[model samples]
Target: MDGGGDPQVAGPVIAALMERAAGETRVAMSPETAKKLIGLGATVRVESGAGVTASIPDSEYEAAGAVVGDLASTVAGADWIFGVAAPDVALLSGAKPGAKVAAVFDPFRDRARTDAYAAAGYEALAMELMPRITRAQSMDVLSSQSNLAGYKAVLAAANTYGRAFPMMMTAAGTVQAARCFVMGVGVAGLQAIATARRLGAQVSATDVRSATKEQIKSLGAKPIFVEKVAGIEGEGSGGYATEMSDEYKAAQAELVSSHIAKQDIVITTALIPGRPAPRLISDAQIATMKPGSVIYDLAVAAGGNVEGSEPDVIVEKHGVKIIGFSNTPAHLAADASALFARNLFNFVSAFWDKEKGEIVLDEEIGTAIRLTQDGKVVHERLLG
Candidate 1:
């Protein structure tokens, strides 16, 4: 997720513009969102062909009360710039001085790009960094997008595997159900467990938090990492896992390596914010997996947790297959775009004054999302 929203507005707001992000298949504003924004008293303009990759036709936007135009024409007088990722900084710099830009712009991993948006005079709202508070749940983009990613990761792994997920009965004998192991228990991991179980696979999961054990068990799957991380339980904040001690990591590696050998499908979803993904599977362990086993590394884009998992590349090592595809959610673009677009709508609606047709962003939620304003960095973590 990207952007910093300049939530303060007193006068009439211009159109809530959705420009086509080059090479991005996910559109920030879907037809569903256009209708919602229209009801909020904001004229919505979606760039022509913006949602085509998501298989949404232009007629859909028109039907939702949004005008379709070329990027420049749509962006003119843009008060709110909503996007899936960061838009071209130069393109947004041409907007009005107080214009606001909101998107899933990763402010922490790539601070320079975010800073460029600030220098160009747009407030950025990194939707992923929205605090995990009760009120902001509807606007939580990371969970929405990641939930899709986890579901897709399993489907991808299952499709790649030559065998079936569920047990089969035959005149010969009863075939055993595929064994699936999921690493990490965030929104993505939980979805992975549910998806695999729905496919009738024997699912087992691991997480650094003890809290995940019940969730894992409730899904009728076994919980891993319960014994190994005892002393380091609750080592994170905001429901995210923090860095473990070197010794604890070593123990985890030993435990996870042994577990990897037996799994028919392995999905690694471990990611520490602003850091390389924690390495859970090593090359030596990969070598030990059965020749036909498939490992799907969701963390591959963040420097994979599984060794030899290349970004967007598939490789087989000693008979085992390693898959590392970037943007798994984008692979399921239609729903990903819909969910993401809704998140953007909810984020804007949270601050929009329906009566005044203006944005009021001074709430505490603003403090977590607004990265820069008035040509200055506003988020405390970004400043440090």
Candidate 2:
């Protein structure tokens, strides 16, 4: 496991630093991952206080065999730098030349940062682009985070609503259960449905993909779909939903308009990678909802699926409240950090070469996630 007594060679040095992105509370590494990386013969370093926001203290990382130090010391000579978001290239000055940085680079939206990483001669591994394949599921940051985001969205919406989620049989009178309508049955949407049902809401959901109808039903929720409409089979590559046909959109809008007016809560989770979120609920549609209804837009950071939805702000229109978060997963910092750290660890360990004491990615995953290498932006999607 130690690669056989090489006097001059040291195993790879892996490092993690505190996230600097606004509202980002998740740390890229946890003590659990630190211990695992060390077991694989890598020297793990975590910047001091990196895990504070995630409820992990430096002493815990030290207990897991990680060296905790200041930013400069932690990054010095590191071979792999992990983060929740790609750190600014300036913060990586002390790392080895061409060191690998695995994180969400948001390459399509922020070309400047990708270029900076390329110019600095670092390998940028955009985890968000992890290919949607069977073997890569455990390493998928999006699915893991979105699963949590879906749960959080429902919880937040339920909190904001004036009525209780579950019906009550009290002494005075019976309280009817709240109605929850989920738009876009992706990972987040599915979780939102499950959560709402658990909270005792009468749940119904809709998605562009007709396949999700069964999934919604499996979760004990009603599936509202536009039948006999073109573009209803919205499955796209990587298991994401593609844009719907104009006719399908009009039909779905008509269906939703009638359904939403009787609902108490709506959760919208539709997002196309590298594209603005598809508009699902217009202002006019929102205006038709009951006065006290609540809508949670999980895609608010991606320009929103609901009209007038602003990240981190609750805007009221026509007596309805619209709310969203710029970073929904961050609101559940502890669990989000643990899962995210495991994702990075899983990715590296899967490709680890025990004899060489390093990770060696195969073509399939490497091609999908490697955004920069050898002083140029190399990902095919970014090349054009």
Best-matching candidate per lDDT: 2
Q: lDDT by residue for model 1 over 256-361, one digit each (tens)?
A: 8888889999999999887899888888998888889999999998889988889788889889989977778888889999998888888778888766667788
Give a tens-digit lDDT track for model 2, residues 1-384.
222123432688899999999989999999999999999888888999999999999999999999899999888888899999899999998788889999999988899999999999999999999999999999999999999999999999999999999999999999999999999898999999999999999999998888898999999999998887855454677899887778888999999999999999999999999898899999999999999999999999999989999999999999999999999999999999999999999999999999877889999999999999999999999887
Residue 45 error, candidate 2, Å:
0.1
Q: In model 2, which runs have C-alpha deviations exceeding 4 angstroms? A: 1-9, 232-234
lDDT at position 262, candidate 2: 95
Native-to-model Cα distance after best TM-score fit, residue 109 in candidate 1, in Å: 2.7
lDDT of each: 0.82, 0.93
Task: Tell me how far the alpha carbon of residue 180 in candidate 2 is from the true structure, in angstroms, after superposition.
Answer: 0.2
